[model samples]
Target: MNTVLTLMLVAPLLSAALAFAVRRHDQLRDALTLAGLGTAAGASGVMFATVAADGPFVLRVGGWHPELGIVLVADRFAALVLPVALAIIFVVELFAIGQRKTAWGSNPELSGPMMGVLTAGVSLAMLTGDLFTLFVAFELILVSSYVLLTHQGQAAQLRAGMTYVVMNLLASTLFLFGLAYVYAATGTVNLALLTERIPELPDGVRLGIGAWFFVVFGTKAAVFPLFSWLPDSYPTAPTTITAVFAGLLTKIGIYAMIRFHTLMGMDQLGNTMLIIAGVTMIVGALGALAQSHVKRILSFHIISQIGYMLMGLGLFTAAGTAGAILFLVHHMPVKTVLFLVGGLIENDQGTGRLDRTGGLARRRPLIAALFAVPALSLAGLPPFSGFVAKFAVISAGIEARATPWVVLALVAGALTLLSMTKIWLGVFWGADPDRVSVRRPPGNRPMMLAATGIAVAGTLTISALAGPLFDLSVDAAEDLRDPEIYRTAVLR
Candidate 1:
């Protein structure tokens, strides 16, 4: 009777409905959104502790037979991930509570109700025990994101939304086909049951399904050859929306890939992700170097960072999975902090265009410091969360003797450093003849301050808690390496 997991899943949904009904009241909507997210955070934390203490918890919807019903799982990995996603969503929502003024009132771009559904969908995607249920969650997120993407009513945004919609629709279709394949082959859609049945299938069928899973998740993950949609779509959204998307969505896709590979006999696909990892990293880093806008640079870096996580998953060892988990945890905070700070810069400076900006360091040390900390961390500087993440990944790659991918990852890291340096020098380091400082409204500054402060603090806390956090990730990876643990928990 894991009440925490159940509440964590359902609260945001109820809150979403309530928030939408009262859309005319800005303060009420904000309060409802914050309250819902706060409750979800508390619930997810309790679930994490419960998972560690009591093992995996499963709830079968409607109390039907496992094969006939939907299921939600609160496993070691889900326990760890749900809170991270929720935290970012909360911070981004706080940021939006001010900047977003909809026709309704406060949520011009991302209404409180939409954010609630988005967070709920993320949690559901993490917790669902079957592909069909995950598909439903995906639909929820897709609908929420599309509305927000077109919020600005810009031609560029509309264009970006089309690409995003087309690609994800294709991915969703692939997910349905993949789900059908599993049901046809195994007679059950339950992940636990599939875990039990998959090993008996022919090797060719397994490989074909593996390929399909990659195409489906790779598009979602924004891995290369299917990656163009992300840089276009993400940068066009409102800053808060873009920050949330950068921090959570693609990580969910990577999470799906890692889970599928480890649990469902798609370890054969590890090498495929390995090749894609190196290419995605190099290409993305190069793209970051080419960008002048702060948002676009960060957008490209998302692709580059994903490659590092893929490297971890590709190695297919506990050490590798551990690296992936830690890197994922590390990247979420860093990415959110970067985007919040970037948006703050644009809000005050009249643009996020680096070429038009200068002299922030001398003029606004706080904003400068915010950017500098995560910037160095993003480049994998030591004593930061990013260092912990990158080292874990590179060490695992070296141990596996994946020399080519290792070299490419190192090169990507160097390029990440170079790109950050470019932004620093362009936007903050050099002298501005105008000597422009952050001149944002004092009222609006609270939102920027709150969002960036909380994000960077979380990033620092990751470093402070690295040993314990890394151990938790190791425990989660242990479960991934041995799916029998997951299977037994639900089936029994």
Candidate 2:
């Protein structure tokens, strides 16, 4: 178990270093990067299975106690989410390999190494057993992402990267301060220990801490008013970078919110979270409806979908948390695949502006087919994983009698479907863009398509396995709702 956890964190960093070392050799760099990601993804799968069968596993770095040193835990929640998250990164890296040969790919010189850094950060963020360590993991991710976004040095990318970096910097500052506040109030930053010490604080102090981290994580999650940076920033990056950001980055923020709030028993703030969730839903959907560009529309939809996950967390029930977890799992690959298809559309027709694209359903039926499944899933249509996830969350809200929030969620779903329909009609059913004939370079289209196909297949697999996944989520949520389960496992 310890070896597996170590590989999940170390393999990526090692691969990243090696890839950077041999950056001049294209094939070798790509191979090393993929191998590292593959290793982490495989380790996460093993950890997930092992934890499910045995229970949570903890790794104490340098053989030190939790209070004084770093700790990593593969609890049910981490175990369940890690595999999906790592798998998405691995698939994106594969797509990146194929994409780098195309006009829309990220800079081949730096993208491979940077992606490795991002993968390591993600693994660390998910597994860290303490608040301070989580913050460190966030920096690792933010730094890699900053470089990824701006490495091309295009004017628009630089402008958007500034917004992305500044907002995240402010949030990171607040996060550090929150860590201090937590330590001052509780005398330690270890999550398991905080679980014991936090509830003992006064109600005002306790909720203050909860609300503080809420803003910190919520900014990262791009919820509500804090989300303007996401739609503006995401669409400016290369397609592969945007896909990873859309799929994993904001979701990490909500992941933290779920872990922190649930384990610390922040149920009192449920109403506040619910209100924010509703506003985020409507605002994001409206933003999507207003977009003319495919990437921007999809970017806005990321915010809209976040509202559902927040709604689930706000319900603060085992069912709701499970719903949120299931939603996170479903959203990652589905969102990534959608963005990859957007990339394909742009690469094929020269633009992602919906006004400039049409008739892809006839001209490139495969890309159209690839887009449809995830699009329907994103719209929460029946028999898809998104529908199952949305049902779980909305039903939890209904059971909790959170009537207004439930209504907002339903309205948001309708708007989401409408926005998706806009994409289909504008990009797939109308006249194709008019331009001079330019032959596409016989680049790595097959590899890109194959990578995308794998992701699309993964989303379908999620839909097929929804029943068992939800049951697993329920167990994870049970652990989350009862802090003692985590507290005991880590502190024992």
Candidate 3:
């Protein structure tokens, strides 16, 4: 368990250093990058399996106690989410390999190493037993993303990157304040300690802390009113970078929010979160409908779909938390796959603008098929993982009798379907543009397609295994709702 945990945290950073040392060798750099990501991903799978069979486990870095030093816990929640998150990064790395040297690919020299840093940070963020390390993990992710977004140094990218950085910087500042407040009030930043100490504070301070961190995490999750930067920032990155951001970054914020809020027993904030979740869902879906670019549309949907997960958390029930967990797992890959398909469209048509492309169904039936699966799933169509997740969430909401929030969720679902239909009609079904000319780097199609096909298969696997997956989600949620489970596992 300790070895697996070490590899899970160290492999990516180690590989990143090696890749940077040998940046001149393209194949070697890519191989090192994949090796690091693959190792961490494999470790995540092992961790997940181990935790499933044996329950939660913890690694005390440097043999220090949880109260005095770093701790990494592989509870059911962290273990369950880690594999899917790391796997998405691995597959995106493969796609990046194929997409390199193209107009759409990130800078080949830097993307690999930066992704290594990003992967390590993701592992740290998810596994950390304390809040301060989560902050450090966020910095790792944001710093790498900042470089990734602006490395190309195009005017649009710089502009978008600035907005992205500024917004996140504000969130980081608030995060620091929140951390200080937490430590000042609770006497320690260790989450397990906080779990016991936070709720003992006066009601006012406790609620204030909960609300403060919600805003901080909400911004990262791109929840409504804090989401304007996302649609602007994400579309400007290379498709591979965008896919990683789309799949993991904001979700990490949501992951943190779920962990922190629940463990601290902040049920007083549930009604407020539900209100925000409703507005976030409708606003995001409506925003998606208003976009003409594929990436931008998807970007809005990211915010919209986050609303569902937030809604689940807001319900503050075992069932609702389970639904939220399922939604998180389903959204990560499905969202990543959608962006990849967008990349394919951009590669083929030389643009993601709906106005600049059409008739992909006739010209490239495979791309159409690739886009259709995740698209329908995104729209919550039946027999897809999205449907299963949405149903769990909505069913939980109904049981909780949060009728207004439920109605907004359904409205958002309808808008999401409409947005997907708009993309299909504009990009795949209309007559081919008069001067349609395909643009792609030679010999890249097979690898890109294969990578995408693998992701699609993964999504199908999620759908097929939805039953068992939901069972695990519920078990994870049970642990989350009952904070003693986490505290015991970490402090033991």
Candidate 4:
């Protein structure tokens, strides 16, 4: 089990090194990239299964003991998110293989190799059991994303990368300073140790530290006031890059918030989180309503949908937290596929502006069908994962007597459907961009469609398997609510 976890981390970095080493051979580089991501995804599945069957598996690097060594713990939450993260990277990597001409660059190896580094970073963020390791993993993700965002060498891309780079650096600084304060006050940075020590601190001290956690993670999660960086940045990158970032990156911040909320005993701050969650959803959805471009609309929805996840956390009950976890897992692939479908639209007509793209329904019925699944799913339509996930959150909110927030969520869901309707009508039915209908080109069309297929199928499968997944989420939520379980697993 330890070997599986370690391999999940090392395989990607090793493949990244190999990618650059054999950059001259495109076929070899592609093979290495695919194998690397596949290996990580496989290991993630094993880790999840092992944890489910035998409890968490932990490893201490350098034989330095838990306090001073590298601690990696694969508990239930880590098990769940890591596989999703790796699976996403795998799908995007495979899709990029057929899209190398413009989607990648003159050398596709550069972009694909960076993905390897990113997989390691995301895996580490999920698996590492300490603050410093988490910070380092975040830095790894940031570095790779900078390259990916600007891979096209376009001025717009560089500008977008610059914005992300500057803002993320500040976030990282805040995180470091916060970690320093946490360590200085508690004398240890290990998550398990902090879990034991945080609850023993004075109220004022705890409030101060918890506030820092909120701001630091709020920026990453794209929570309301702190989400200004997402909308513009996502649209400026390549579509696949945008899709990958949309799916996997922001969720890390949400994951951190989930991790520490219980460890730090965040009950005192529950009301404040609820307010933030409300504003985040409304603002994000309304922002989407105002957008003309498909990517920008989807980008705004990202912030809006995050509000739903935060709602779960703010309620902070077993059911509430479980609902939030389910929302997170459901949104990841659904959102990514939506963005990919948008990319396909942009590919067909050379624009994502709804006003510019019309009659796709008649021109490409299959593409429209593909878009409809995740679109309706994202809008909380029935029988899709979104509907089930939202039902959980709303039910939990009502149970907690959070009537106001639940009302706001209902309004936001309506607005979300409106936005989706606008896209459907404008892009698919409004007008045909060409004088005559045209089928999508052969190049990269199949690959892009296949990516969307995976996302849709996975989402529907989750919906079909909602009972088991909700059970898993309940277990994860319980583990989170009782940090003692996690602390004992790691410290023992």
Residue 468 deviation, candidate 3, in Å? 0.4
**How do all models score by TM-score?**
0.96, 0.99, 0.99, 0.97
The C-alpha local distance difference test score for the whole of candidate 1 amounts to 0.85
What's the true lDDT of residue 336 in model 3? Answer: 99
User: Which of the two candidates, 2 or 3, achieves a greater lDDT against the reference?
Assistant: 3
Model 4: clashing residue pairs? none
Worst 10 residues of 4 by lDDT: 434-443
Model 2, stretches more than 4 Å misplaced?
A: 436-442
lDDT of 1 by residue, 330-435 (tens): 9988998898888877776767888788887887789999998998898899999999999999999999999999999999999999999988998887767364
lDDT of 4 by residue, 1-492 (tens): 878988999999999999879977988998998899899999999888989999878888776777888899888888877888788888877667766664322237588899899999999998998989999999999899888888778887777778888888999999999998998899999988888888899988888999898998889899989998899799987777888899988999999898888666788888899999999999999999999999999999999999999999999888999999999889998998898888778777778888778999998898899899889989999989999899999999999999999999999999999999999998999767754322334356687678778877887888898888889988988888888898888888
How would you encode candidate 2's per-residue C-alpha lDDT over 72-103 as one tens digit per residue?
Answer: 99999999998999999998888888878777
CA lDDT, candidate 4, residue 26: 84
Judged by whole-model lDDT over C-alpha atoms, candidate 2 comes out at 0.94
Residue 38, model 1, lDDT = 81
Per-residue alpha-carbon lDDT of candidate 3 for residues 198-283, written as tens digits (9 for 90 to 100): 88899999999999999999999999899999999999999999999999999999999999998888899999999999999999
Name the 10 consecutive residues with the lowest summed lDDT in model 3. Answer: 434-443
